[model samples]
Target chain A: MSDRTDPPGRRSTGKLIVSYTIVGVPLLYGLVATAIKASQLFT
Target chain B: MGVTQLLDRERTVAPPGYNRWLIPPAALAIHLSIGQVYAFSVFKNPLVERFGSSETAVAVVFSLAIAVLGLSAAFLGPWMERNGPRKAMVLSAVCFSGGFLVSALGVAAGQLWVVYLGYGLLGGIGLGIGYISPVSTLIKWFPDRPGLSTGLAIMGFGGGAFIASAVSDRLLRTLAPEPTAAIAPAFVVLGLAYLLLMTYGAWLVKVPPPGYAPGGYDPAEDETGVEARDITADQAIRTHQFWLVWVVLFTNVTAGIGILEQASPMIQDFFDQVDASAAAGYVGLLSIANMLGRFVWSSSSDYVGRRPVYAMYLGVGAVAVLTVILIGASSLAVFVLGTGLLISFYGGGFATVPAYLKDLFGSHQVGAIHGRLLTAWSAAGVAGPLIINILTESQRRGGAEGAAAYRPSLFVVVAMLAIGFVANLFVRPLAEGASDEDIGRRHRAEPAGSPG
Candidate 1:
């Protein structure tokens, strides 16, 4: 029964961008490393 | 915003029409970052040479960290429940990543004790908190599919090594190739990176409001035949079901750990023709199997029911281990397939347990209860390696050569699994009665806010 509109902070687009960026950096690293390793496997 | 304000649960409650899918990535962000603990093996050779210590001494660092992880999670579960996920996550981020930073400084100074305190003690605590931080919140957001929802997040923990293995190796090589000098700077970089990543998970994570359920699902009609009783972590420990699940997790993890710890060596020892490189590749394949099983098997557990899924995990896992012992040396396919299935169940076991807890005890403090149960993981982590390492060494001394050296040890694991299977069989559902939350609700009579 506690349903209401989304809270104030969650509304900000900037917050989403920042969170994505933080997670994105490591994910990008992981992807690049995978790509390099995969290329080696093929070559 | 204030620190507490930023982490406040009321603020994190999902809005009407909010997509539940977004929550898993938030969990993944934390789990994957913390999951890098599995990839700590990449640093082994370097640490041995740097501290001028034996490999066993260096391994103590990893073992200590895992031990502390379980300990802190058990103790900190309630505190986290009180503060909510975002706060716990931020705190975990600081401790986990900060442990690396502190350990880096220790390495730079050539102080092994400092490394233990930072990486082992501090970072381990961070890992425990980061792990449980998102779980309760995720369950709240996706009550309709507890197994699958938790699986998606927990699978990230399994997959963490896949990402970390390649990346950590590259980071180590680029920043400081010399094993002795490389560890400190590499730790610094990884620590900072994880700090950022875990913080993102902290920021992104949210809990659902009281009585929240996804659209189109009625909790009352959705019958898993489980009582809607809320049990606190303290109350849960009093139940036989909790200990049964504990033993189940302990035995399953022990079996899996024995295989994992011995992965590369076991394959090589079993067959003379397979070289180290091939064994390494095989280990990688097992890693893939392990990661996939987390998602596939655990998600499937939703439909299959928690107890049967575990029965399958322990029962089939025993068979697979037995198969490896029986004809693994003679046939490579049998060895890989058996070990692969075992590995999948290993990952599956970890992923499925949270949902299993939700089924037995209501979601009301499921996170705290899950945290308490992880002590089984710590015990198994130690016990598994000890059984594998000691028995194999004893066999080697006894002149049981090659694959024969491993048989005695593997059989011991099978015995352990048989006990677990029995434990799984006896895991009776909790009696339909007043749970702790109900008692508290009646006593204090605060309209019970649904346990997140």
Candidate 2:
């Protein structure tokens, strides 16, 4: 079994930010779009 | 022998691993079921007749399923990695099967929310988990052939819809004389079959033996000169390349789905002068093209390299979309050919992405990255349908003439593919510092010669 203790790279911080950005931006877009559509449903 | 020796012996004899052959079957089970999403149009006319609901309302179920697929995969990636694929596959099968069961009950009771909850939310979970379960494992087993392995597994996903479309159509025709009643039992039967198939697949999976490697493989001999890395899922999320890839995937998927959502209508519109039967035949041909592209074009990536292959997908795909616009309703042949090529590239994009991930990030955290990136599919699922629906609805309201309304939507797809092509151009080899350290660490830490 490989040792679990060794820290890999701190660079993944950049990746994490980018990932969240990529995931979050479109997600937020979808939510806003859905909200807009839902509002239209009632109107 | 001492305990350590005994443990080592056990590791050598039966690695905490799954049978490689089992992965494909498990993948097929999940894919075949979730592929039903593509057949939602079959139910559209029926639902309108029975429930007195609008097209938009019925479409929401599909949108919800797709949206949930990404959400579940994003949230579930780490858990899947920790628990192993077996647990993930089992959970997926159960949720997927249960979704159908719930939807059946909902249909019987005439409740829309139940269908949404059952098929959309629960089935979506199955879609996400089943989608990702076999990918990383297949790559691990065939490290020397990441492109081929991932392509084989994903081909099943792309083709699943083709199978589901046929099966569901037949079931609808033969099983129940009425639309609403016919679909509920079909759901029940399909759910039970998928449960059994997925369960068998889950049981068949095992991690490869410690120190096991495929025969005749040497990392140093490869031209990509790409080395394996041991980055954790957490570490993988920190790189710019990962997010760049995410964008590429997002654009590609969205572009394809945009066309897919509007395929039948678009074909009929373009071929308005032609017979309806001919137009329907063209639609079926597009589906076949999509299914074949998943295997043929993606498998070709194994030799041509992922970057060049994706560049073709975007560049050619853009032209294909534009060709549809240029041709308008003038020539049914041009429209059919263009639409077929677009669908092929769309399926090819899905099949090619996992290999591209392996190329950039290495196989260590590929499953996680793949899982994370699948959020793009979810996003595209929503975007593609919404863009087409909103545009088409507005065009109809404005009394846009035949084929002209579709022009704006096709342009949107073309723009998206253009963006994806640019992203593909931006792709380069991962930084050496990152690549080397990852390889060195993983190499040393690996238990002997095990398949990654």
Candidate 3:
């Protein structure tokens, strides 16, 4: 099921983005760097 | 009352329109952060130089952390279950990130024991709690697809090393101009960062209300043939199946870790034609494979079943190790492929074990049982490196050449895998009424709805 607004146990889009940014920023940073290192080693 | 009330699992039932997809990302937020524990070695050299301690002394920190991880996961299993995943995750977030903050101070002051207390002791408990908290909740939310759901989060743990190794290196280089003095600030920053990430996970995590399965999934059709009885943590340890799975995990980990802990050096030692850079590349490739196998093999187990999947891990793993031993490093491709496949199986063993637990024991306190099983990992962590290092050293002393140096050690791993294979064969269903006795005991012992 999906909800638009004011749902129980479901986070709002703004809240979701805040949570994602907190976790995603570091993970993305690391993944991008890993890609760079992989390229350097393979190429 | 507000944050606590929001965090209370009883108060957090999903809305009629709650989307289950949001859960996996919440899990990943914690797993990926703690998985950075595997990359703790990135700081090994810097730590050694900074503290004027031997590499062995620095290594003790990692070993101690792993030991604590197993011990706490096992001992704290019941408490974690009673409190719920949300509370468990919050505690993990605090201890793990706080360990870094404390260890940072230890580094700045050069008090090595305090560093051990911070990262090794406190951080290890964080690893244990962070690991088991999401497991039961994922099974509850995705009852029809436990393997696939758990695999997604576990893969995040495996991938954490890639993120941590890369990010920590960049962070250290930029932040620490006085390289030795850099560890403190780096620890502070990283700790704060992980706290934020894991707190988001804690904030987001919610246990599905009892009996809430996904729509269109028949609880009747979902029968795994394993009886749906509630086996408490205490009863699980008393069962033959638990010990057998423990041996299976220990051997699988020992064999795979024997290769992983020595991947870089073993590659160079085996192939004189391979340079240092090439060996590093090989090690990197194994890390990727290790991460991939966590997702692929574990997800596949849902279709093939946990037993057959594990049989493949143990049986095929033995063959791969044997291939390296017999063939030596004559063909670079074979060496790489063989070792890489073994690494995949190693990761697969980790990803598949929880689903196996769910099969043998019912979902009731499965998280607690899972925590107990991870003790095998701590044992294997020590055993793997010790076995590899000792055998290789003795071989070198006996005047073994290049690839010949690793042959004895690799064969030893094959023998270990063979034992694991035999143990997997002995894994049958738990005896009848074992769950009943435990459940009855729990009912008499505690108030309704309290965790086992």
Model 3 gets an lDDT of: 0.82
- Cα lDDT tens digits for candidate 1, B1-452: 88788677777776564555667778988898888999999999988888999998999889889988898889999988888999899999999999999999999998999999999999999999988888888777777788898898888886677678877787778886576788898899889988888887776777776778666667776554453566788877766778889999999999999899998899889888877767777777777778788889999988888899999999999999999999999998899899989989989999999988888877879889899999999899889989999999999999999999999899999998888999888887664565566544443442222221
Candidate 3 local lDDT, residue B40: 94
Model 3 chain B: lowest-lDDT 10 consecutive positions: B443-452
Question: What docking tier does model 1 reach?
Answer: incorrect
Model 2 chain B is weakest, by summed lDDT over 10 consecutive residues, at B6-15
Which candidate has the top score in TM-score? 3
Off by over 4 Å in 3: A1-32, A35-43, B2-6, B431-435, B438-452
Chain B structural similarity as TM-score, candidate 3? 0.94
| Candidate 3 lDDT for residue B122 | 96
1 or 3, which is superior by DockQ? 3
Residue B243 in model 3: lDDT: 81
Candidate 2 lDDT by residue in tens digits, B1-452: 65333222123232332334444554555555566667667767666555678888878888788788887877787777666667777788889889989988877777888989998999988888878877776676666677666766676665555555656667788888776678788888878977876676665455555444565666556555544456555655555556667778888888877877676667666655545555555555666667668878878888899889989988998998898788747876677678778888888888888888878776766777788888888778778878877887788789986788887777888998898888778777655555545644654565422333
- Contacts from the true interface found in each model, as a fraction, amount to 0.13, 0.00, 0.18
Extract clashing residue pairs from model 1. Answer: none
